[model samples]
Target: MTAEILQKVASEGLPPTRMNARRLFGSFSFSHQPPYSRLPNELLSEIFLYATCRGVDDRHEIISTPIAVSQVSTRWRNVAISTGALWGTIIITFPISRGQISRALTWLKRSRSYPLSIFLDFRDPSWDWDLPESAHPFRWQDMEALIRLLIVHAHRWKQFELLTDTWAPIFTILHYSRRIKCAPILESISLSRCNAFFAARNATFAPAEMKVPIALFGGLLLDCLREVSLTGVHVDWTTSPLRNLTTLEFKYLATDVTPTKDQFADILEACPNLHSLTIIGRGPQADSPPSSSGSTATNRPDSRSKKSARHVELMSLTSFTFGFNDMDYALEILSMFSFPSIKTLALENLSNVDPPALQSLDATPLLKRLSFLDVSSDATTTPFPLSHIISLKLYSISASQATFSQFFDKLRNLEYLGLYNASKDVLEALKPSSNVDFNSSILPCATLKDLECRDMDPETLLKMVKLREAVSHLGHVSFEFSNLCPTLRTNFLDAGIDVVVQTTAQ
Candidate 1:
């Protein structure tokens, strides 16, 4: 009967009566079924939550994962609706419209009483000032509405991030949302101006000046806040709580409001538990000395006086990054704070500074990972006290072979080395001499295991690899080149070295 019914249904469409088709299918005992069909509602809900969690950055998944899973079956729909955690995160990407705003509100509503993690990004390509005014797609009303909706549940916010090209809208939102004085659960806040347009154009753009200092939550303390990141935005630091911050980042801040040595010293004094610090752009000038209040004696060997007051010490700081156009300003800032626990250090645009400025870093003996970006050849002449560094990365830097050989020799315990846009002389210096015995010549980085180089001669690299292997077996080598020699690649592989070669397009 089932076969006859199936044949009739295939010859013609399903019977005009839906009941007859339903009855026919119900009579068949189908052994083939989807695996997920047998999963319990609890397990299915967990799977949906995992899928949403994994693709938080993907706009399509953020909007459709829960809805798609719910549509799979009636049971799934119920399960998804009941699982509030799946809808707790509301990520609103750029080019947002009324529809997206409405959907965002709906998702938040579905979250019920679950604590929220919200990421609102207004970095649309059309929003760039370089584009025509008519190209702008966002509406002030829509933005205000979305901000209002999120503010309504501000007390429940656990993580909030606002990224926009303009600071006006954010300031306006905060100004109007004065009632939101407490976010008891809020732990992290990141507010920054979008610089993607400038980055894409490879042009530097001046930061827009603000008429007033920014303040959040009516200048009240956020007891739960632990991490704060601000870029190109000035805030009233005196009123804000800085005592409990574990991670703090300030980048491209306006010169007028940038913290001076004393002000930054006060901040360091406030945050005794700070672990990571990143500073970029021009910091406060060192013309003014730090305050005498709570200042401690200098521990640096280069200190001029035994009783000279130094800036507050970051007792728990582990990582420090300095990137700025003025190397003098960076060095001056470094002289203010002493980080006894610093383990990782990154210096960008060091080429602008005198090599002696880096010598101030002798205090950080625990630094294990060191990175140099756009450092001048002369700066390499100054022997940095990075003997403890196991990993070194050099980018867009030119140095003589002798300088590189000497620098490499200092890193006796180095294991990983990365060279990008390296000069020919540097590569040649790294290559082992044919006549020199491996044990006799003090080769640079004798303990080196992994080497990464970009835009260098393949033959030179091959020789260096062979020489290094002769001394100490290199485990992995990666190269990015406009052209790669097959013979060289094969030779490295034949020697049991892991070789990765990527050809760059012209």
Candidate 2:
């Protein structure tokens, strides 16, 4: 039977699921076969819907989800063809040839009245040149025509994601999608063009010549929109459909092209129900570029001209990630919001900022329920006022023994701690004190039950975990190591500690 199964797989390929074992077994059957076709149309249709959405995540993973199900058998085909929602999640790559449009339309038609989720990737084209005899460049016209087809069904779009390396396809989409008056049920939209690195490295390659912010989706009514993520894509924040967002991310924008501080303030005011927010690269820019006058900020470090920021209270936001390349730009946005209900906070100073670069981040006034903190900073002392943080992740951080002890002293309730590229002094501070009466903060806090470290010294790790285990503080430990001793893992396992070891590339 095993030989038969292998032989069949070696010859006739199976469906993506490869679940039809009874049929594959051929002649080795039970007294009665289960009535798979006895399932009601509605139940079968629901199964088909599940099959399509859960297919492959890439084309190597994404291609065979629905189509493979439909081609299984006549009964399966009929059932799948009757289910419109099964075809609603459309994934297409651009530069569509002449024949691909008909196929795309078939899927669109089969989708019927169901909501659509479109993922269009026009990244690296397979080929832009077809014929050597004549000038047959990549079918920009055909691609635009395909987008036009998609635009015609824009009313059904529930989720749309368009990503490209160049900006030309985005322009094409924006131009054609203007006809959409309202995506009445569009829930999430992501439009990204990752050409910022090129723009920064080579000043000559400017997309749309760095055009002014434009109204996205032809100023359509996005009453049902919930999540929006834009990277290297300019949109008029003041007039765009940015309100009522549960998740909002704007990244990889230039200072000149970002929303102005006033506009961003209005955006925050409008998004009262926002839950998760991320702003990286240059955020809302000040009226004047901070670097125009050869200064870090408009207000000098000595002048203390920190104007009262237009504060907005985020009562619902639980996860907030903000990284900045410019000090004034970072402060300009940080001083504006108070994340009173924030649970997960990630602060990243992308640049080598000066001492008072994050002075505007007075977390005491903003945060009240922060339980998870991930910070990428090179500071001697901890920045945020964290009282309830149970999980803490530090990246690219180094602190002295005194400072490390002071920092750990504050995280008395910290149970799970992760360190990546942390300095040696930070580790040395974790050495347990011999004095049993010594305060936990004076030593490594014994409250820690879980530890995760990346690219750290194995010797230091073993000693630290062993000492902490002696105090019965540690129950679980996860490590990412290039080379580790075999007995060390065995020893920890024997000690009944939950050990998770991940091997990194040499």
Top TM-score hit: 2
Error (Å) of candidate 1 at residue 244 is 1.7
Instruction: List TM-scores for all candidates, in order.
Output: 0.71, 0.73
Q: Candidate 2 residues 100-174, lDDT tens each?
A: 556568778988999988887766554332233123243346458668778888889999998876556666676
- TM-score, structure 1 vs. true: 0.71
| Candidate 1 lDDT, 10-100, residue by residue in tens | 9987555657876777644566878888888889888998888788677567668888988977888889999988887788878776787
Q: How close is each model in CA RMSD to the real structure?
A: 10.3, 12.5
Tell me model 1's lDDT, rounded to 2 decimals.
0.62
Model 1 / residue 152 / CA error / Å:
1.3
**Per-residue error (Å), model 1, residue 94:** 2.3
lDDT of 2 at 362: 22
Give the distance in Å from residue 14's predicted Cα in candidate 2 to where it truly belongs. Answer: 51
